[model samples]
Target: MTNDRRVIVHPDKPALASSVAARFLTKVVDLLDERPVVHIVLTGGSIANAVLEQVAQSSARDTIDWQRIHLWWGDERWVPLGDAERNEGQAHAALIDAIDIPEANVHAMPASDGGLTLDEAAEAYARELALHAPEGADTPVFDITFLGVGPDGHIASLFPHRSGIQVTDATVIPVRNSPKPPPERLSLTRPVLNASDRIWLVLAGADKASALGLALAGASRDEVPVAGIKGRRRTVFFVDREAAAEVPERLISPDY
Candidate 1:
């Protein structure tokens, strides 16, 4: 099936979260219909986690074959296991904790607990993917990667002007001195993000207006790492009206 990148703008946070959660449910349902198992890469942050919370509240959550679904992280703060700031903890608090998905199927990036350095964690994640993903695939495995754009145009740990944007080999890498707090992180590189089957970038709030403007203006990927993402399957942007207001009004919605 040919997939088209879609842009949906909602009026409020609740509306945006519900809409995104519904779409996620639909996508997972479709994938499950096609195959027994679905592999998804999850993102962290208030907006992305809100989507998961909304999904948990939705009636459709029960329809998903949670057991057959596999989950991975797009990036993670390099903190000890169970750190409140950790993406794994955020996800668990929002949805995973409520769901019946097998613990073994949830592939969280390495935490500091395993005597693994950040680089070692990245390599370990790559090995895990190699073991689970199909042979000859573009990069390990991921049916979809959910991304959240920082106000400064960062995605995952590939912050603007960071060297992780240039990574080509390993799908995941350790990042140091990140612009945001908790300086250290592990992130999926641009090459890996570009290789994903689908990418859904969720943006909301008024603070993101300026960055959205720069991205739509055809900013260089190296300058705005979020803009660097190009997926082979499909790419989509889900933004609130406030966040997308700066985009050319004409491109805001084709239906308009």
Candidate 2:
């Protein structure tokens, strides 16, 4: 881990969600002021959705020009569009639909319903990313990437001991039989996720304590995907007290 890594512990889940949401909005506002366009990669999970919901409910949602912001997902279930298992579906109901962002700016991975096989879907997503990426790059330089740390120490669809976690050359890859349910998913590779300027990993509950501990302890990337998660500038773990139980006090930041 880098010296820039920070662990922020909140009193509880609600507090954690609220703080992350506020930070997200403020950061995006600042990015908008500094650049013409900003791209963010979002993750899916209970805590992640809670944060998005908080953003939708806040009056600060109107502070930025959503039209200039582009949103992408860190990973997505390879299910039909509108399926409850789809991350994009959960995201739309939680925040996207409530925001004023344009349809063209929302870069979602291809869905199974789009008549593409899992491999084809992954290829299509890579192509989409390349369109916005810099010259000679396969993926875009994401501004901020929001990721959820699984209790199993997985991030995106890259689970422990999985071949997907070992891949660094691809922009996106198809994950078959993921340790978690729905089996199939399309995930951006670590190279792509790590390309971001800031990485915010969110987690809650006592169930995640063990994984959080392992990750911060410098667990091998092949065994703990979260251990390899980092950004170009800053990497932060936004965890609730329950999930912070095993996180060393030394890594915990004093305040927001």
Candidate 3:
């Protein structure tokens, strides 16, 4: 594992979500204390949704100024606005709607019903990022990004050996022929995701154990896209015991 990485294991899925939620809340509050606004990227999956639900139930959630918390999706299914498969939709139903977050601060990707082509939607999302990016940065320096690792080690829509993983110039790209269901999607490229100050990969279930192990063992990013993901300041993996089953002892933190 890389020197900047940390592995935190919880006894179960619920505990993993709760622990991550606590850390997430504290991180947001600390960032807001230093600035008026903080940008965050959200991911989708059972684990990610659970974390959002936990965040919604956090007692300290009131400490955050929801209006100053800008939300962005790390990747999104190219379906209609309210489709259950869409990450933004899941996030909204799980947490966003329960908070006082301003509508303008919620930057959801364009859906198929928006009358734009897949490439067009991807380009539009990239334009949105460029507009909100801090001065002199190609992409917004997200305060923290939450990602979920597929059982196959895919992160976002960047699946193993896929062309999407090779994209470096574009901030976001349209994904076609994805190995997973609902093949059509939009995802931020590696460079864009790696621009974040911190990254948290949330994983659970024994199905994810092997992939997580290979990723942390320094596998090729092209073969294991999640392996390439690292935050400028910190990269962390929050896994339940089931997911951590195959992780190397050296990568696992003794006290985390």
Runs off by more than 4 Å, candidate 2:
1-3
lDDT of 3 by residue, 11-122 (tens): 9999999999999999899999999889999999988999999999989988899989999999999999888889999999889999999998999999999999999999
Cα lDDT, all candidates: 0.85, 0.91, 0.92
Q: What tens-digit string does per-residue lDDT give for candidate 1 at 45-101?
A: 998999999999889899998999999888999999988999999999999998999
Deviation in Å, model 3, residue 234 alpha carbon: 0.4
lDDT of 2 by residue, 1-256 (tens): 2448999999999999999999999999999999999999998988999999999999899998999999999999988998998889899999999988999999989888899999999989989998998898877778899999888899999999999988978889999988899899999888788778999999999999999999999999899999998898999999999999998898999884
lDDT sort, best first: 3, 2, 1
**What is the alpha-carbon RMSD of candidate 1 to the true structure?**
2.0
**Each candidate structure's count of clashing pairs:** 0, 0, 0
Error of 3 at 190 (Å): 0.4
For every model shown, what is its TM-score relative to the native structure? 0.94, 0.98, 0.97
Residue clash pairs of candidate 1: none
Model 1, poorest ten-residue lDDT window? Answer: 1-10
Model 2 C-alpha RMSD vs. true structure (Å) is 1.1
